[model samples]
Target: MTGHFLSFEGIDGSGKSTQARMLADHLRQAGRDVVLTREPGGSAGAEEIRRLVLEGDPDKWSAETEILLFTAARRDHLEKTVWPALEDGKVVICDRFADSTRLYQGITRGDLRGVVDRLHDQMIACEPDLTFVIDMDPAMGLARAKGRQGTEERFEDFGLGLQERMREGFLNLAHEFADRCVVVDGARAIDAVAADVARITMDRLSPDAASA
Candidate 1:
């Protein structure tokens, strides 16, 4: 059986990362071979690129330059981490993926959605088998993000305005990729959200669904 690729996406502090980790733990406890990783720093090379992108000032690089950096990091991640684990038939749960770029760069960086798409098509032409977008209000999400402390605050520091825009971008993307994207309301309790994610994931991984 081939491994399944699953990704979790949301604006910063939408609890997507927590849900992703919870799902990974759930799958592991159920005896599934799983590899939980994240971008833009899954593999070593990608980690180096991640620093370049996530550290430094928010405007350290142009939108186009940042896109290229992210694509390069993703390429390295797929080559060194995701592909190999999938080839071994291990479920790969990524915290974030290309959809993040499509939303973040596409929204904050001016009219670069077309360039983002083109770069994705040319370089990282892969999508998760399933993606869960945790939807939440930007105000609440920003509050949650602000509670955390880290030097990797470049993106998180964009504040509530950008997050609000990002929320819309994610919703639109969910509609655009409805066949493979599932939107989960994230304003509820963490356990409630995790339960929803797990149930959906298991249904998707069932024999009938997998064979389909």
Candidate 2:
């Protein structure tokens, strides 16, 4: 874990994916090695699992089943993609990680947060060095997510109510993991949000960070 691991999280359509990519690009331009990946699907095996979890009907899988699938995918991702990159001291910017699971499948449908945590500790014990929780209004975020017209709309198809709950869940998660979490308002212009992310990341990467 010599390299920095970063993750972006938010309710659906919170522009976290975009910010993750922007931060990766920013780091790359500064001559740092960057590996931008996303979870539920970062490696080959994980990508296959991603389609299973992200596509199809909203009820295709139970919350319990989804947790298993996500944890398995995360395990594969770490073995095949994340660990190797980190071993090489590359910046790994992930679009989503275990946090998303802790929300989407954990608290949203039931009181499975404990289950998710236990499985995460047992199977995928990785957490980002830094996490950016993008904050956005649920309704607006849902609209943006729907606008994508992508097949990965299974979660979005869960509708506005789910998004609303997820928003609150993510905000609370930021507090729970405050040391490594930074909540960024995502309602602003893309460049503005990106700029803030870049600055924050650079500050964290600075040699003085430990002192600061």
For this target, which candidate reaches the highest lDDT against the unseen true structure? 2
- Best candidate, TM-score: 2
| lDDT (10s digit) by residue, model 1, range 15-105 | 9999999998888877788889998999999999998999878878888888899999999999999999988888999999999999888
| CA shift of 190, model 1, Å | 1.0
TM-score computed on alpha carbons, candidate 1: 0.95
Predicted structure 1: lDDT:
0.89
| Residue 177 lDDT (model 2) | 96
Relative to the true structure, candidate 1 has a C-alpha RMSD (angstroms) of 2.2
Alpha-carbon lDDT, every model: 0.89, 0.91
Off by over 4 Å in 1: 208-212
lDDT of 1 at 158: 74
Q: Note the residue pairs that clash in candidate 1.
A: none
Clashing pairs in 2: none
